[model samples]
Target: MDIVFEELDYCETHMGDLMLRKRSIPSLDGKIIYEVKLGEEFLMSSLFHDAEVALSHLGLDSFGTKQVDVVVGGLGLGYTAQAALEFPNLRSLTVIEGLSEVIGWHKRGLVPLGEKLTQDSRCRLLHGDFFELAQSANLDPEHAGRKFHAILLDIDHTPEHFLHLSHGGFYQPEGLEKMARHLHPGGVFALWSDDKPDEGFCKVLESVFASVEAHLVEFDNPILGGTSSNSVYVAYAQ
Candidate 1:
């Protein structure tokens, strides 16, 4: 028999009830999976990371072997950021996280890939709300009015479901247009969605971008004992 253990941590944020936990699930082979949570919801588990990694590959694939600057909006488990760094042609990667505790986890080496992503020379961890920063004239505090080759986001559940009510605005045409201003010409904007692609959302992107695509990323779900899927929305700047 395998024993399950959980050590919970708490934090306070304007968004809502914030909590993070280290869940250890053991199996017959002594394999274990670590998970992070927010409130009552399961945020990210080490076992299911294919979709997170796919967010990087599918988003950056079109760039080919060219050196490019990138920004990852969320840094859950560091899977997406780590995947972006795997591209040798990637020049720089800046990860903007809403919660300071999440960034501290990587600095403190609490998560598996956190330490490695933090140690990478090409990766820069910044403390800020990604949605707010994306709309700002200066995306990065160090570099004013800077633009990136690619901007990948994995913050909300989907266009219809948002973590905070304020986040809802970012999905609108005006908000998306502001984000586009932070992208270099022909740059890509990618977002990870927990739900299937929404046609309405695609139309909104189409209005603001030169091109748009939604990729269905499938992965094995150990919890459900079946396959699961997520959507990665990629758009190009004009």
Candidate 2:
């Protein structure tokens, strides 16, 4: 098969240069892949999204089968948001994406899950800084002070390794407390991390939430010829 690569879109933002691209790798059976990059860092790829899907399942599963209002911190290929809608009990999903370019990829059908997310009435892709919105009393712009049953975040690589220095505060106790206010009682907050589980961060979550658990999500890494893992942290409000 002929090798194919294309840069779908590119734009500059306050954080850095944001880009969306699609390509097919001959070595990997020429499977088409969608990728997002921020400056030097590769934000997400369609090729490996097991953990993203796991973030939704592990988070919402805590609520049992009750209808849930969910807020996803990052849109990244729409995997997390799309997975959230898979739950029959999910009443609504609000995805907060900091870069409009990322959201445009989905709106323009540049990514695989784009149309699925756009066509679904339950999902709303809102352009805003998640950290900033998380501090607010509401995640949905249309509904002021509206609380949610779950908030699944996949923004930074990890709580310790932030995409931006400003994001560091959100991992702190004060920041977590502010975000917790937006969740309904017994609601859950879940996060995806590229790094291994951090005991210190779990302690911080334990401080604000009634219960906390960190799950290790492992998946096949075809490119690397082995399994890679990500961590998901779930915390329940009192």
In candidate 1, which residue pairs get closer than 3 Å at backbone N, Cα or C atoms, i.e. clash? Answer: none
| Winning candidate number (lDDT) | 2
Total backbone clashes of model 2? 0
Instruction: Tell how far residue 222 is off in model 2, in angstroms.
Output: 0.9
| RMSD value for candidate 2 | 1.0
Q: Estimate each model's TM-score.
A: 0.94, 0.97
User: Which regions of candidate 2 fall more than 4 Å away from where they truly are?
Assistant: none
lDDT of 2 by residue, 1-238 (tens): 8888999999998989998898998988999998889999998888889999999999998677688999999998988998999998999999999988788888998888889999999988899999988887766767898999999999999998899998999999999999999999999999999988999999999989999999999999999989999999999999
- Which 10-residue window in model 2 sums to the lowest lDDT? 133-142
Candidate 2 local lDDT, residue 149: 93
lDDT of 1 by residue, 1-238 (tens): 5565656456777766666555445532545666776767777778888888988998899899888999999987799999999987999999999988889888887777877998999999999988888778988978998889999998888988888888989999999999889888989999999988889999999999999998888887766777999999999888
Highest-scoring model, TM-score: 2
What are the runs in model 1 whose C-alpha is more than 4 Å off? 26-30
